[model samples]
Every structure is written in C-alpha cells, then in structure tokens.
Target: MPYSITVNGAVREVDVDPDTPLLWVIRDNLGLTGTKFGCGVAQCGACTVHVDGQPRRSCALPVSRLGNRQVTTIEGADGPEAKAVQAAWAARDVPQCGYCQSGQVMSAIALLREVKKPDDKAIDLAMNGNICRCATYVRIRAAIHDAAKALEA
Candidate 1:
C-alpha cells in the first residue's frame, strides 16, 4: 500500500509495506539518509525523528504507525529551534564519530523544545537512551545548554 506521510515539510507518498520501518522508508524510498540506523531496535536513538513533535525511534517505528502526524527528520528539521541546536552542536563540537550527530541533534531539538532551559539532570533524562560510542556526552550537554541559552536570549 501507499502511505502518505508528511516528512520534513512535504507530504511524500511512499509505496512500501506497512510493516516496513520508517527509517528504511525515509532512507530508501524518500532518499533521505540523515536519519541513521544505529540499531534496529528502539534501544539506540540513532534513528530518532520527530513524530508530531515527539522524538521517536524511526528504526523501529512502522510506517503504519505513522498517520497524518508530521515526521521531521534531520533533513526536514528546520526553523529557529533547529538552527539554535545546530549552532550549539557546532560551537560545542558535539560530534566525534559524526555518525550519531544527526540523531543527537534531533534528540536535542526535542529536549530543548520541551525544556527550554534544561539542567544537567534534565538533559540526562531526555538524552538517556541516545548513546554515542565516541563518548561526546559532555560536549552534547554543553551544546544543549548553549542552544537553550541562545533560544532564551
């Protein structure tokens, strides 16, 4: 069946199996590779995306699970919030391996949207599942803080 999903900001019609993961559909069908596939399960936040403004693990999220909800991937993640997060990520040098940055940035945008000024504990709680093998947690936290500050001002 063909599923009409709103990805980024455009409504794209993808003819794929209902059980197919959103990550694959976004990558293969949509030709958007910003969302990574760290783990097929939801344990890894590598395939994190915004589903109706919520951070979702796209790797495990079935295409059927998404309806009219707006699915925002790294490619489609824009606006002042995304720019702030991107600026913070660059300023703090958040990525080491560069594989997890997109997911991390997506997660951070979600976190910042919810918690305008997230503290260490809040950041930890929000970014708990997203793992970085390069161990850039410190910088990620700093970038989140910086983004919050920039958004605050």
Candidate 2:
C-alpha cells in the first residue's frame, strides 16, 4: 500500500506494508538515515523522531499510523532550538560512539521546546529511556542546559 506522509515538511509517498515500522520507511524507503535504530523494541531512544512535534519511537510506530503527521528526523531538524542543541552537543562533547546521539538530540529538542529551562529532574524524566552506552549522561544534561541558555540568549 502507498501512504502519504509528511516528513521534514515535505509530503512523501512510499509503497510498503501497512505494518512496516516508520523507522524502516524513513530509513529505507525515504533514505533519511539520520534516525538510528538501537533497540527495535523501542526500549532505546535511538530511533526517536518528532511525530507531530512530539518525540516518538519510530521503530515501534507503524507507517500506517503516521497518516498526515509531520515527521522530523535528525536530518530535518532545524530552527533555534535545533541550532542551540547541536551547538551545545558539540561544545559539551556529548556523543561518545555517536550511535545514540541522534535520538538523544531529538529528545532534547522536544524537551527544550516544551520546557524552556528544564531542571535536572525534568531533564531526567524526559531523557530517561535515552540510553548512552558510553554513559555520557552528565554531558548530555549539560548540553541540554547549555542549549536552553543559548535559546534564552
């Protein structure tokens, strides 16, 4: 079946099974590979993407369920929040292996978009499932804070 989905502000059509996960559709069908696949079961946030401005686990989200929702991947992420988050991540050296950073960044963007100045508890709650094997939680937290400050400035 062919479904029309808006990704990164563009309406894209892809022919795939209705049950196919959005992650594969984005990566294989659409060729947007920035959204990584860590845990296919959705336990890890590596496959996170913004579905209608809310962070969602793409791996578990079927393409049929996407409908007309706007999907934003790491490749499509932009704006002041994205710019600040990217700058903070780079400045703080947040990524170790970098496999999970895309999801981490995506989650961070959503958090910052909702909460301008998220404290430690809020950050922890928002980023709880985003696992960094290198254990860069401290740096991730710092980068989120820095990004928030940058947005303020």
Candidate 3:
C-alpha cells in the first residue's frame, strides 16, 4: 500500500504494508534514521516522535493509521525548547550509551513545551515512560532543569 504522510514539513509517499511500523518507513524508506528502535513495542521510548505536536511511539504506530497528521522526528525539533534541551543535555552530559538520547531529548522537548518550568514531579510524570538503561535519571532531571533555565534566559 502507498501511504502519504507529512513528515518534518515534507509530504512523502511511501509504499509498504499498511501494518508496517512508521519507524521503519521513516528510517528505511525516507532514510531518516535519527529515531532509534529499542524495543519495537511501545514499552521503550526510543522511537518517540511528534504526531501533530504530540509525542507518540513510532515503533508501534502503523503507517496507515497516520492520516493527515504531521510527524516530527528529532530532526524536526528545532524550537527554542528543543535547542535549550539539546544544550542542557550536552551541558549536563546526560547520555551514557547515546542510543536512547534521541527519544529522551524528544520527550524532554515535549515536556518543556507543556510545562515551562517543570517541577521534579512533573518531569518524572512526563519522562516516566522513557527508559535509559544507563540509568542517567539524575542527569536527565538536572538537564531538564537546566533546559528550563536556559529557556528562561
């Protein structure tokens, strides 16, 4: 089946099975490999992306289910919040294996977008689903706070 989906402001037509995970289409067909596939199930946030500005797990999202909604991957996150998050992650040295950083950053950007100055509780709730095997939770929390500060600056 050929499904037309808009990704990162570009409309693309990809031919694949309807049930094919959007992650594969984005990575294999569109050649956008920034979104990692950690678990294939929605359990891990490695394939997190924005579907109409809301973060979603692409690994389990079927391409056919994506109608006219816009998909934004890490490559599309260039807003002030994303920039701050990126800088904060770098400043805090958050990533350990670096495999899950893309999803972590995406989730962090979404969290900051919703809560300007998120408290630890808010951050915990928003980031609860994203699992970093390196257990960089401390640094992740610190980076989120730093990103909030950066946004305030």
Candidate with best TM-score: 2
Ranking by TM-score: 2, 3, 1
lDDT of 2 at 52: 88
RMSD of each: 0.8, 0.5, 0.7
lDDT of 3 by residue, 98-136 (tens): 988999999999999999999999999988889999999
Q: Distance (Å) between predicted and true CA of 99, model 1? A: 0.6
Off by over 4 Å in 3: none
Taking the tens digit of each residue's C-alpha lDDT, what string does model 2 give over 1-153?
A: 999999999999999999999999999999999999998999999999999889999999999998778999999999999999999999998888999999999999999999999999999999989989999999999999999999998
Position 7, candidate 2: lDDT: 95
TM-score of each model, in listed order: 0.97, 0.99, 0.98
Where model 1 places Cα greater than 4 Å from the true spot, the runs are: none
Worst 10 residues of 2 by lDDT: 61-70
